[model samples]
Target: MTASDPSGPFRLLAQCPPGLEPTLTRELAALGIPAPHQTPMAGGVMWNGGWEQLLRANLHLRVASRVLVEVGSFRARALGELVRKGRVAVDWERIRAAAGGDGRRIVFRVSASRSRLYHEGAIEARLREAGELPDVAGVGEEAEPRTRDPGEAEEFPGVAGPGDRADAPGTPILVVVRVHRDQVTVRLDTSGAHLHQRGYRQHVGTAPMRETLAAGLLLQGPLEPDGGWSRPSLVDPFCGSGTIPIEAVLLARRIPAGMASVGFVPRDFACLHWPDLPPDVWEMEVARARAGIRPLDPERFAVFGSDRDARVIEAARANAKRAGVPEEVHLATAPLSKAPHPDDSGWIVTNPPFGTRLGARKSLRPLYAALGRSVQPGGRMVGWRLLYLSADPVLDHATGLPLEVRMTTRHGGLTVRAVAAR
Candidate 1:
């Protein structure tokens, strides 16, 4: 029982595509997190929970792009009052303790939609005063205190105030201020860096899809959720560096996304400064991840990747091996139209060349047409859903096969639309 859990429920905010909100909501429900309330804002969703629920959401959520903790929300007509109220609302002492030994690096983000009291700089100033600005020195003059990239040490400028010292351990806080019609809502970021990194992809091809996007696309498929991959036979006909199949294996095995990554924003955050987060808890997390990993059945799941470019296929094979799923994934050099069929009912998901970067515009239509024909009736075919992302809408029309649009999502700045036919 941590102090946060006993004090009261914590408010959490998660961001995802508008169309996929229902799916994300369902995902939260499965994890036992309180049902989230949908906000009218674009690309934002709200939920409430304590520290335990926050950790669970970070570990188990497959659809959320990022998870944030709500610190406070209030109405402030002017900048002065806003800062004063924000500082008083948050428990700075508790936050400082959670950050390990570093004073909380308070980050502020302001968003205003149709509001008269629209001043981003003012909101930021208030947040800094409230967070007890750490002393950051030697940074360049152009450096804005809040937007400093974590990778650049010189950019951080040491600490902001006299209280910030090397030996002083405190929580690093990120404050996001959203002002709509005089209403100011402030939130502290709990999950740093978009949740999609998942850490494992050491090798990237010319263009690689994010793990989160791949998972969302898979969720739109016919794959069962309840440990269905025990004997899973997954195939990505256009597997670029094997992201889809790799993510599938991770989810099937219940591996934590951060296990493979060296650094995450959460690791350097102030929340870990809290005394409640004992070192044993982190060790236990690692232990659970290790125990959950089971040897994948090469014959059953039979993960496979195919690409027209032999070099890309080679890269995918090497990447799968690096991710520890080499034996499970069978990489081969084949075009989408010529890829071998695993089983009549097997899942066939791919992100075919969209001809956006590669000079393959002339070949897209025919390639999509051939792909549609390849998936015989009663089999599944999922592809990038966005109309602009790919030049093959005719593929759906050409297959002369009945198709259903399952979900629409965004991947790497391109909107993706997933389709399936049973």
Candidate 2:
């Protein structure tokens, strides 16, 4: 069935960091979404489901950055063709119905490539013009196209208002138009903000790890409420903003990832705003997701982290407290050599500085070497399975720890490999 079919299933794209597509696919399967399909591109996994599944994904998925609903799509060879197709093919009525009555803040984001319509501006204007075409929501047929000005929303398109942060008060639906070659695919940002904005980490270190990637890394094992195993020791030696450890406790506690983002997407989605739905619509979904939480004893796992910077340790503690995971993590300040280690055997997941700065590359070797020496079998940190991110091959070799490259992924525009030494 098409997206226009009000009750029909539509495709949802769970966007993730590159190289974690398989990880995300597995996460979805574990969430009860069977056999998710990977797209022919980086950073996307496709699954067919209804609004319930869409909401569940936004609520539970830790590996995805955002969830995009395929609202409409069509083949367009020209800007005019895109406008014509966008106006007719887009099930505005469907969205309108979802929002109950009609008339809401609708934002059109468009891009074009290949084909004859290669101009992004013209394509955006065309789609914008189409939306105003009487039947849609905003503009009129004769109204002048808006001047090109991408406001803050466009400036940080990936970041929507987080939790209760009101970035956009009008509840606007973000429409993304991707014209690859000549195929125009239109999608709706079901998630207002990037899922990485997990309502925590208001204060971040210089290089903060994204929550989604942290969750993806956390998925390395079934370190969960579902994995027959109770909690094994989980540690993040380089816990800058405490993302890894925070996400670990979130999983161990079985807390929904989007617990605080309840009002962000569905309520702020313009078309799917709260007032538009039945009183118990979202409440039911929220309850269902919450019910899935299997409360674990707070003492189940020996999870903790440490950093060299005292200030960042304070920030990590505060952030964890705000995330409601403070009790789940033990944060400390120590040098890499003094990084915390499990008493016996434990998992060490961390993202050290990539040394992207000019002169910083020289220090990587010694840093990795020191870390290697610290976690070796004979030390207090002995028998610790270390998971770290590495970019330069020379530095990877310098670690001296027995780590195998299990996967290669991009982080902050750099190709970093996740190396694990068990």
Candidate 3:
């Protein structure tokens, strides 16, 4: 066991969507990391922990999009200062030692905002020179050397270059340098892919709900528990690809969201490759998480989904089966006007289509009205409530229900809000 470091700089940054910081904070707490300091609007919660804590996060965090470990921060007024601060000053060996000195192939990236170092290429150049590592043998895709202009340094020594977005395996270290004014904050991305790519949904439908956003909607939205859905009859009338309902059932079952993420990057994570860490640490954690799951009571959790397209229903079924919850999910195909209601009353959560064209949007009113009526048809009302995500207020207005805005967050670069109604 690594001894505790009271004055050590080992810190993990859990990144979530903006405005969902508090929800992620409580989630980390529930998993035994106490009092995560909230970085609101930034979508990150900073907490002190070592390698094990970092591994636990990638295994457990449902709302976090990625987990970043801070490497070092320094003030650099010039390129030379940046290089010096990076290599000798920042203690690269100690940072590598944290990973137990396992040689890794580093892929470095940098971004600058409001900084005097406006030249991103120069900044990238400096980081490469400073924190250089020996290149991995026979790993990573080989590509022709990228040409450099006038004063550019020779080929990036020990760096194998940028990774292919499609095949991300063997990608260990991703150095992120964020420069603002004279300050530079360096971090290593521990989560290789976006957390929402939960590995189960090989198939997807239009405007599909992101697994991270789906998890946030299930965990943080007050309309759920407050609406008396203890076990939650999670219904997504327009359930495209079954992201919401499947995520709900997984959360209810106490299943680690990453349990079946077949190609999860935790094994390829830079620190895990380091020599000092145990080879079975990640496997043991995965096993422990598997042991920790409190499997669902067949009759306890109710999850159902329906869609206008028969194809989407078919897709949802396949996705839910791959997620190992086919028995828990019930799917059907029908237009919104003929949407089926859950026999057992449950809260409704969905990300409705955000029509980009006005004419296309106008045609969606009846769909929204059908949604409103489906929850509380005509005069028959239940204790159940509806929480749906919509991009346009004008679109939501057609639902004809008095929607109280619950939260506003971005979806697919469009500003969207989660509104609740009965």
Candidate 4:
């Protein structure tokens, strides 16, 4: 309960976009989490590790959306039972410490199905009566698994970014409660904002990709498989706001996605305020992660991006600069038809327009066809892999490539698949 008291191993879950479980597992494995400890589920990876692993997951894992710690679980068949069982099950002292010594408002996201206490509002009300808990509010409508890039900033109002004091007033602590049948489970959201809000993307264009999803595509998609953590040259012709290129460089350079990079500030997490966490532990882990970053070798590893819109190109430049890879990520303003072909065949990964409107699909056919031709101008990219996000298989066929659907996921409120011509 207190910082000095001995606590058991933390039950940690690294949540990611659905369909990225395997990728997330591999990332954890690379982070030195043993195979026996990792349990890959539908939308996240679970493991029982100590405090350092939790800090490493939040500070270094690129594809995860958030990291959560399970505090308690108990059987509560009725409201009264729920109050008694939940009160005993939850470590209220730990919660108080995590709330920075009480009176802080905690957001409770509650969901119930096939349970006796099916009323979510009543469940929250009863849970509030459990102890001298902090003021609670409901985070209405659980967010759908993020499969696409965010367009604008939706960070929590009082949350802190990197280098800022973590004890900002009104900074929220989120507690998740789920009930099924006769069982109740509770989790604490250590990630204050979504993991994709890495703080570099201050500017964005239409239909931009999320940084986490972009890293997933690069890790799992087709590539030339260069040895020793080195990746092949990456090019994104439809690179709006430069998420793919920036993530590509970050991945190859071994940069911590959530750590501060040059001009970009890092975002704060809920766990930073927990009293059980020693300040030196976080500082040491951050220092260790910073030491892991290696510079990209431009000759062997090049990342290029270009967009037809001049305005977004400027945004991409600014974003790349903030991400500490301005020189590594080359950007230009050109239509897909005029996209320059790289001398060396590597990989082309992009999120093209999905044409989600009523009849826009018909209008984008020629552009898809042009994408097929432009990348292969003069047979320069004959062996290069083309990986893209496609909402319609019909549009993929228009590219005149024998592309296979690699992974099906959501993007921009539409069902999209990562199709690839390997």
Candidate 5:
């Protein structure tokens, strides 16, 4: 069935950072997408959904990086057969419109394994020759084969590099082609830029945490109440660019990650440019999401973020302003030794220096110890839950608090774990 079908059985995939599959699955289940319909894989969660589901997945999913809609699948062991079948199996015109309309180009991101058509570049060329794909020179045509990390997401059109831009007019749409065991599956990226972008964090600090991951960490805190909404407070002692506190404010206010507080997505999504999707459908979805936003309850809840660096705190203020929650998140320039402690208990979720990014392991232990002192059993922040990202268990132990590893994931070539004390 077509994607515009109100009750279509659209095969959709929501890709996220590796090791966050379980959290992403729980998010989908909370969205009312049945567990039986979801299949959690290594890098993403696949499910059968309809038009509304597709829109909601892109708009509301806090952990997913991008959403892909499966177009078709076929068996092709040879390049020639692949092209022939792809031409018949896929809808070219719809993809063209989604790319940016008639004259826009297309980029192929091909991954092959255990199949005869192993050359991803060659497969891209064959697809272009079949007239199924628009022309894109030197896009994925690598002369030499190379290994790619499986966790890497597809590159953004204009953000990667100057040469990554399309020679033709308009933004190029990315079409994912995967060949595994002689089966070729084609899917289209519905989310244009990565969801972490959020269009607010134009300015960032060194090794800043992704907004999506920050939101996911907040989800583990004591925020959401039982079948109801509760205004919960949070603090980020190591808030670099204010991602954690900003995301916390977003969650507290029910502001969609894709949307700003005023109810508009700053950067347009690929699905919005589709020729088949009705304009009213997207408008209705945005209205529904905007209607759920609750006013900021400053008296009952508060979010504070502080860093030793003044420049990053300024950047955080700018980002919070762009996110339309400027006054809601209190940002300051201070070290972890002077982190804000509210009179009432709240959550402390942060991404601290992992030694790989900021400071030496030996020098950071004292910082972790100071952090632990602020929230340890009988400390000033007693009854507060603590969660942080740590690359070294030694550093986590330095806190002197009994912390358990909650989740582990790769960040910038380093394996980091989310350690928590509750």
Candidate 6:
């Protein structure tokens, strides 16, 4: 089952939170790719593209959860039909070639939400037949590779042992089959890992938000949709290791999320089966990033951050330097109420430590109240918006400001509310 033609690119599918579908679609549209077709799955969206577009999605998308490529889609009414259709749809030769001629491994994921055809083993067997690969039975058998010896860790090469699957290299073709009612849709996951794990946040503090999530939160605030962070001087009063500020700089410079990342799940995917990706693509991206990078002049626009703990402020400074936006940010050691004042009309966006994650609800009330006062009349302005994630509605009363709750969403298993005061 060789690929139809190496020239014909595979059908790529990218997934993200339902709330972010519109933002992701707009991002793809800017690259000249067609808008993604929406699906009912939670945090799922579908898009089509080749290797270059796939790379661009991984690098540029600020809100997508993960990107997957569609390998095949078929309708199967019964177990036998599933087996037959699944095996016939896979291109074994292409899978083997993508694996660099090694014995290929196939993973089958089945979802039978509203259908009677729910047989996991049969589906796995069908996928195995499709790829012409041997299934190493049982999870325990896979775990045996780790106990061979500490020195044998490197012997397995690309195979991941027990807890380290994130580091595993060499693409294994994954078959994801979702059966809704009587229809089965099978897709091959091209982006192996979620694109958010850019591998830069070596040091993280309590409840550190993901880079992608932080970027989305920022965009939802004062930042423009077209990747511009120039206006409304951004400030993260609770700057935990500076994830938000660092992401702001990346957005300002038009630097793709995964630009500094060395590995992506898509890199190992079989889709690169085409003539090697254009040699200058990467170089051109880098040059574009350099050209678009806004000079990090602290005085130009107020990108300020502050934290009560001096140690956390140190961490934020270090992380900002690593992100190549050290000069663009102003760091200070102070509580949220005392955070440095930027231009009169800037935005205050921070992920304050929630009572659940930070502990002791009673202790944080005073802090929230003070935060409200700091952003009021003489401090910032009527146009200044305080976008924060809080579980306590009492925070509005604590702030003593007549703020309108604009939007709310769940992040890190906590309810986040965005409030705007005009």
Clash pairs (backbone) in predicted model 5:
none
Which tens-of-lDDT digit does each residue in 1-422 have in candidate 2? 22122243767787777777788777677666666243425667887766666766777777777778787878888777887788988766554543334444555666555767776556767776765522343332122233322211122232345554323444445566778878888787777766777777888998987887787666765264243333368778789988888888777766777763222232233224433344364677777766765555634566879998988899898888877766668889988777765565677788888897657888777987877776776665776677777777777778786678777776766777878775
Using lDDT as the yardstick, the better of models 1 and 6 is 6
- Kindly list the per-residue Cα lDDT of model 6 for residues 307-355, writing each as its tens digit: 8888877888777776656667788898765778665567788887777
How many backbone clashes can be found in candidate 2?
A: 1
Give the alpha carbon lDDT tens digit for every residue of 340-394 in model 4: 6567777888998888775899898888987776546454456677888888877
In model 2, which runs have C-alpha deviations exceeding 4 angstroms? 1-7, 36-41, 94-105, 133-160, 165-172, 222-231, 260-279
Q: List the residue pairs that clash in candidate 6.
A: 192-265
- Whose lDDT is higher: candidate 2's or candidate 5's? 5
Q: Is candidate 3 or candidate 4 better by lDDT?
A: 4
RMSD of every candidate to native, in Å, equals: 6.7, 5.5, 6.7, 4.3, 3.8, 7.0
Worst 10 residues of 1 by lDDT: 153-162
What are the lDDT figures for the candidates, one per model? 0.57, 0.67, 0.65, 0.75, 0.75, 0.60
Candidate with best lDDT:
5
TM-score of each: 0.76, 0.83, 0.81, 0.89, 0.89, 0.79
Question: In model 5, where do residues sit more than 4 Å from their true spots?
Answer: 1-9, 100-102, 134-137, 141-148, 152-155, 159-169, 224-231, 261-266, 357-359
The lDDT ranking, best first, is: 5, 4, 2, 3, 6, 1
Candidate that beats the other on TM-score, 2 or 4, i.e. the better one: 4
Q: Per-residue lDDT for 51 in model 5?
A: 70
Tell me the tens digit of each residue's lDDT in model 3 across 151-245: 11122233222222312333345555678777888887666555666677878887786787787787645323112235346677788999988
Query: Can you give the lDDT of residue 188 in candidate 5?
Result: 86
Which candidate do you rate higher for lDDT, 1 or 3?
A: 3
lDDT of 3 at 67: 78
Candidate 1 Cα outliers beyond 4 Å, as residue runs: 1-8, 34-45, 94-105, 134-173, 224-226, 229-232, 260-275, 278-291, 356-362, 377-400
